[model samples]
Target: MCVHGSNNNPDIGQLLEGLPTNWGKWGPDDEVGALNYLQAEQVLRGIAAVRQGRTFTLQIPIGHEKGEPLFPGRRPSMRMNVLDKGHYLAGKAHFDGNVEFSDDVIFMHVQGSTQYDALGHVWYDDKLWNGYDAMSTIGSMARASIVPIAERGVAGRAVLVDMARHRGKAVLDKGETFTHHDLLAAARAQGTAIEPRDILIIRTGWIGSFYEREAAEFYSDFVEPGLTFSRELVEWFHAMEIPNLVTDTMGNEVTVDPRSGVMIPLHAALMRNLGVAFAEVAQLDALAEDCARDGQWQFLYTAAPLKIVGGTGAPVNPLVIK
Candidate 1:
């Protein structure tokens, strides 16, 4: 028999029965005092006992023609082809040598698509997370570059929060945003629970429609659905103590912010403050469908970023194993 929390027959009483007797009376300003008062260890152990086991994986291709405009007018990629090459040895006998042949040489210059941002990629107003300056963190002549992240590949248990299914679609459409409540509701609907040390992979299904258009039409505009994380959401993830986050969009945040005039507070808070890692431009359509059909949501997630020396960001091929 499986022991779990259910939306229909929710154990509401059991869920809140352990609340501290003095919950309402506890002072909000007392940080250390609060820690001394709560049963933190016991609560954590209880949560650990009920997690389910299931597997699903998502794949994100790094070089999509539809992603060209992500850099806004920059050439998407370039390739140099080597037509032919021949090598001859001097000490040869039937005219004396064997001819060495080489085929076409190709180099990929990547532009749009999902990528991993190095710690050195962005600085907070001028100060980097670990005290490295922008100049020291990136290359001077070559542009913003950081050490390769492929050397340290990302491997973790993944949890999927299907925002698109909750909204009744394969695509979330441009300009739609997901809230923290939507995430919790989706997990509840899927019969799974999130835990610490997990890699949270949110699927908004924005990338699914990329291939519907012609190559030129797809590359003309770069727009996709994304999630909007509130400060509350950030705090929740921090409290959950997850190692990283991956999402099926270019960046995790929604494209526009009405108040800040900037689009990425979640990135600022997660990367700059919490030091959490993130994978962007994920492909989640297939994975979302699988989870919807099976009602299972965990997966073994793996991703390897390109090993570009001192690169700000590098393309990745992320895979999920069941």
Candidate 2:
């Protein structure tokens, strides 16, 4: 079966109904969906949270040099170094006293590592964000490209809802999931409030497991512990007007949906339909540690995807400052 094709599940259409959506809410030419909520005031709020000069790099290094990517289709990046070998270094000297250095040529899958999914990354039916035809819209550089995200960058107050810490466990076991209530409870426990335009980062302890076990073992079975996808949770995010989100899981949502014949349903709903970007595979363990130690979960979060024009996604090195 084609992964991108519409599901045969009869209730799919009904499931989408009544959920909040921002289609045309900004304008007919709206490219970034809920991201428009992160305005000057929101940025200022994030900046004000930086009480300490400490910074946390939220990205997993690109490619297998660090660790293997869990996604099968996404390959690790390749790098080729070109060393300095000029005529001045040889017997046939040309320059008087100049020397050269080395550079590298890198080939990478944009979403292969810690990365942001562009607004044009996913779609349902024949449509994309703001009801544009998927084929024509994604075929060109007209709308929903990564360039806009790169140019603007994401700067806002980020709230880390550590699910593992809330449940008093190292990680949620396979097949375990958390609900919207659990998220709120976790935020409350952390003394952080989910606010409008806030960048939400949900920690599932999946990355912690990756660190504890063999890289191959962690990447072996693709199971992931993540938020339970429901109308309530998705709609709550909409009502909250969250601009963007990050998660340590391979996919922001659960690795596999409990419902049969559906995969990453929230990905389609949020990115394709809602026009929200997602930064996945974030290195959140250190940030979570620091938050728990300091009793502060709010921080200045910034992420900028590579400026690959008309790309579907690009690797990102997000930062959290406190």
Candidate 3:
């Protein structure tokens, strides 16, 4: 694997010092992390926010003929044919009945497409969310896996903060950064309020650009533009009780921290320390345009990932009902 950070990278522990943690806030055996905030009441809140009957699916299509927007080191999902008319014609396959069937298999990183990351996806100090031992992820994720999230599901009111539109840009420049303050500013500009415990869906237009440009240009020096880590930003998440963060980027936060030169510091500060769930690589162009035209930014955000046992993450098509 192409590990991006260096031996000289600042210690993640020191990088996240002075930030609070939600490790045991739920319970000793807590495994879903911040998804615990998404209770029945949150679902009711989501239903109430549905001002229109319109719906939008936020997942990018997997196995596009051109390519997929993936984390730098990860390959695209590969679809292999199992059986088809061609196989029967070649006399290489047969069915029990007087019929021919087709089957196929896929090889992919659970996180290769738009997906929800496990709370234990990244860790430090030899621990995962809720103080689970990092060793539990040795063979397959035993604790804090995506199973809990997929089984529980995520349903809540969501606000899409379109940073690209707010900045008057079609797409934010590579390696660009934003903070919670920027989120609030953009929400204000959009005339929307970010309520407590709302599913936060942010759009930088990074993932959407994959279709418009060549893969070489898209992945060159690929540092995704997104949320930047800070003590204040982490504190804002804690105070707001933001349950799930959805975004149009591989890593929710900027790929590298400018202040610390650490790769994805928010993966530790927010996902690990604050227990915030991450849903990354969403396609939000359609949703953003709709919200922009209608001036209604809040919606009922609901997603259920494939319930794969021992999966670190699972593909999902998040639906925004407005």
> Of the candidates shown, which would achieve the greatest lDDT relative to the real structure?
3
lDDT string for model 2 (258-318, tens) is 7643667788767766777788988788999999999889989988888988887788899
Residue 10, model 3: Cα distance from true site in angstroms: 2.5
Quote the lDDT for 75 in model 1: 49
What is residue 146's positional error in candidate 1, in angstroms?
5.2
Clashes of 1: 6
- lDDT of model 3 at residue 71? 87
- Taking all chains together, each candidate's TM-score versus the true structure is 0.69, 0.89, 0.97
Winner on lDDT between 1 and 2 is: 2
Candidate 3 — which pairs collide?
A: 52-322
**Which parts of model 2 are misplaced by more than 4 Å?**
1-12, 63-66, 84-96, 137-141
Kindly provide the TM-score of model 1 when superposed on the true structure, using C-alpha atoms: 0.69
Off by over 4 Å in 1: 1-73, 84-111, 138-148, 214-223
Selected candidate, larger TM-score, 1 vs 2: 2
- 1-322 in candidate 1: lDDT tens per residue? 1222234442322322332222122242211111221134423433343244443344444345554324334345444434333223332222336445534543343324567776545445554433345566543413223233456566656678988887788677766777767887888888987766666888877666565656565445344456564556667766776656788776677754323334455555555445556677677788777777867577666677777765666777776654
Each model's number of backbone clashes? 6, 1, 1
Stronger candidate by lDDT (2 vs 3)? 3
Which ten residues in a row are the worst by lDDT in model 1?
29-38
